[model samples]
Target: MYSPIINISALEPLYLPHEMPTCHRIRAKKEGAPAEAVKGRRPTDVTIAQNLRPEVNIWREADYPGASDTTRELLHHWFGRDHSITTADGEVIPFRY
Candidate 1:
């Protein structure tokens, strides 16, 4: 069982652009659409897209040293079965796939 020393760091967040009119139109289709829901006015699709920032690392050249083919392969293979990874600094982070 070869477990690599994973480095834990905050990678840059990825922002995806959304089609506003399409989103608004879709939202408009839903019945009983309220100007405000629960806490506040439901955020528009544009707002939701802006706030939906995610940092992703793939098993390729994209993230480099921070990511590797071996790591991705292992993670994918052991994901649900193993459930965790030991970082370089010795932190055992639990991940759900």
Candidate 2:
């Protein structure tokens, strides 16, 4: 397998750590409800989207100079299956081709 070395020196200086946005949820009250009904209700739990980072590779066909068409096809097929990630909801998300 041919792998290319990446240079991240340029991106290092631009990286910054910050808090991600969060959403506050509120439940609706029923019609003709007493004022005390509102007091009994508490704020809903905060919901945030998960941030997922997956490994990636980029290469040209020329990099694998000795690879045949069959070998390339098999490699591509295997890569898609191997890099898939299962979410908390039990859904498998494949890497974008």
Maximum-TM-score candidate: 2
| Local accuracy of candidate 2 as per-residue lDDT tens digits, 3-55 | 75444432332222221213222332553332221222234354331121111
Per-residue accuracy of model 1 over 1-97 as CA lDDT, tens digit each: 9875432321221221221121111122344442221332235579555455323223222443565778866755754253578999999986553
TM-score of 1: 0.20
- Candidate 2 worst ten-residue window by lDDT: 49-58
Q: Could you tell me how far off, in angstroms, the CA of residue 21 lies in candidate 1 after the best superposition?
A: 23
Predicted structure 2, TM vs. truth: 0.23
lDDT agreement of model 2 with the native: 0.41
RMSD of 1: 18.1
lDDT of each: 0.42, 0.41
Indicate which candidate wins on lDDT. 1
